[model samples]
Target: MIAQLTALERTYAAIILVVIMCVGVAMAVVGRGDLFAVHGWIIAAYAMAVMVVLLRDIDAPEPWEEHFREYYDDPTKVGIILSLIWGVIAMAIGVWVASLLAWPDLTFDAAWASFGRLRPVHTSGVIFGFGGNALIATSFHVLQRTTRARLPDQLSPWFVLLGYNLFCVLAATGYLMGMTQSKEYAEPEWYADLWLVVVWVVYFAIYIRTLARRREPHIYVANWYYMAFILVVAILHIVNNLAVPVSIGHAKSYSLFSGVQDAMTQWWYGHNAVAFFLTSGFLGMMYYYLPKRAGRPIYSYRMSIISFWGITFMYMWAGSHHLHYTALPHWVQTLGMVFSLVLLVPSWASAGNALLTLNGAWHKVRDDAVLRFMMLAAIFYGITTFEGSFMAIRAVNSLSHYTDWTVGHVHVGALGWVAMITFGSLYALVPWMWKRPALYSARLVEVHFWLALAGTVVYVFAMWNSGIIQGLMWRTYDPNGTLTYSFLDTLVAMHPYYIARAFGGLLFLTGIVIAFYNIWMTITLPAPVDEGAASDLPVEPPAPRAWAQAGE
Candidate 1:
């Protein structure tokens, strides 16, 4: 990828790295006796390392100017590899966390080894590190194809990709150092949050600039979802992360909100992070990849547009449902619940639209593991949205709140819907990105599909059973009105389920390892002997004399 870069671009890149190194040094000097100082060193060291790599390739022959007119995919390739690496690491951390629940003495006695410290690492790694990278990579690829336009500039795409990753690394390390804003998904402190804001603005600019350069007159449905994902997430991050840092050098900050308002704000960010970042971004992927892989057009474009606006309008109000039966106002809670129930229409509309798009492709889904991955993801998306809406009700929340049921519900969405769709998309994307005829092994794709399915089922069922049992035990009462089950009893009952959960997570992590090996081998496969000057896409059949080509 680096060998193709023009000399001027490489020189500009090196100059930027030098500036970053100076900033890192200043940060290191200013932030002594705090984790901020350590991150400063990380920044400086990372800048220097990338600089050396750029220097090594600085003198390579420039790429063809004609090739520059094609889609700029170097950043997408790097993003894919990085996403897989983060997925493995984060899933492994998740397995360790599950084990810790089963046996608390699993880790060495250290501050960073505690479950509290490591839990956020696992969450941030999977959500931002793994899932976020996948979104960014796919969005770049989808944007270009749907619009028939190359990215506006090579340098800015690199800035968005690597700069965003820098934020992720800072977030992961800061968690280990016990520095946090103490919010749920918005845990990274003010510095990291500010860095993300900078990265995101550039990301948005890339989207906007590329659209302005599009050859196609009408933007595709996939780009609409991607744009919504980008815009909404920017708003959510800035508003929820508002805070005053203790100092420029210190790693502490206080939220601008206090009390119930704070709780409302945090969950508002949390749930929409799921909505836009997790759901909408992946939905964009699903719209493009599923139809392409199945060799079918979307069944109803009209329904897709309707679903898009419905989801955008309703999900913002639904986040308040998470604070049900709390100190939040009754009307606000009721409003949230109402919107959440209404949200099921659009959610299921999307899910159903995807399924109906598979009208003639059911046979392909049965035979093609790649298609099956997406098929199951759609089913899970439907089921999970229904579960989320059901749980939003006040009556259900009474039993489910503060119970493992909530945890179970989250995994149903995460493991079943999010991870499944991501893997499906990558499976379809990897061969095209590498210009390969096929993956290293088709059987291995089958192996991965089954293992992932099994793991998700096992993990979710254990949580459901354990959660219900925990909730029941806590609520059990005697005739005298005293609780029959102590809190310790609930803890004791969870032991077996925790062990089951760990085993399930290990199974999922094992599938990730297998995928890593498969993808590595695919990337390393030698080019075809007759493949000179050929695009990765398959040749399309010649159309009838009267039929038009591209769809709206």
Candidate 2:
């Protein structure tokens, strides 16, 4: 049966009218609500409806038809490519910011080019632009694979990718142009925020409809993590970006919250943005790609569910940890610290589960670069989570707050863990999508791994030692009890470590360049044989399983 939404469509229309009436009555009752506020809601709802209608129109084909129907290559492919390109650029900007912190004079005293403006640029590019695009691309890929259905709609995937990139371009350019709301991660001007609202809603619809048509016995474990990320981020973005624009072009705006309340709101948005954006979203990639690359099933099906909900429950409370030793209430800070410590249990559960899943397939790690990437990503995940919980502790916070240690911890996750897994997944996916026999150069992939690994090791250790030394120097007191060392003294000591960190970043970038060449060659080679066509060719005898050969 060709599906029809006739009755549901009528209900949707009627609900919009009732929502309008309710808003009118509430505005009259409250006496402070404005026409503009209600108008924004009405327009937002209508745009959502249009998207739903469009989603239903495309009628994505069955999976078996993918090869023959000349599948449009899933418009999400463009989003994945954008994610990879932006991942490099974002990390490059991060390296620039890291360099600035190490050598403050790198800015050369230009206002627009200064560290303060570029800091937000670095953070947003990596988090929202790079991390966000990775989540979108992988979710589309995972959803289609699990559901055994083609992507739900045509125009939607393209709309999402283009609209999102437009948002990124606008936000990046606006920051350089001195346009912002001065919020940390939410600094984009009101116009750009509004544009994101549109892109995100389309993303939500695309995910939901794909789930609705799924043919699997149950939704896979990975979808749970991806769905949580999608859901929470929508709520977070809307609440944090509620502001009154002075005008579209000039970029001035007023937040809905004021004073300490505003600070509270900002960190609340900030930390959870890290939670949902970096932690939850990457967990999605881990669940799917980790097992697939290992050529094995996940160790425990039930454990995945338990940890998913546990992390979700625990992480939302840990956001207040950022406000510790600040004007925020003591109880709130304590609550955050407690939750931060508790988060370790669930986080370790996911990490351990990933490693244990490879129990019988350990040698795959030596042979498969993709497997090696995933396994090491799990190892880094463990290190980052432990460091994160320690930093949230008040005792450690006293020494490490505002130091380079924070930067090191973040890169352990971003570069060592998240970027590693994403790269491995892309390596696996590109060949599959292009239907290539194998990567053009496995040796190149191995070389890329060593370079990235060496870079991350040097980068993290340099920051760690320098940060601890700086903290100790500042806290030291002479016999006179005068301030022991001026802040500048600590800065002078950090030059060598800073130089090392920059060189490490260059090594990591070089690895990515090698990967680009290897992948490009693989895709451009001769066409692969179709599964049906391969039946006409002779088959070779299979090698004995590794475990069986070892036994006797």
Give the number of the best model, judged by lDDT: 1
What is candidate 1's TM-score against the reference?
0.95
How far residue 8's Cα lies from its native spot in candidate 1, in Å, is 3.2
- Cα displacement (angstroms), candidate 2, residue 378, comes to 0.7
**Per-candidate RMSD, Å:** 6.6, 10.9
Candidates in order have lDDT scores of 0.89, 0.76
Which residue segments of model 1 deviate by more than 4 Å?
528-552
> Candidate 2: deviation at residue 128, Å?
2.6
Best by TM-score: 1
Estimate the TM-score of every prediction: 0.95, 0.82
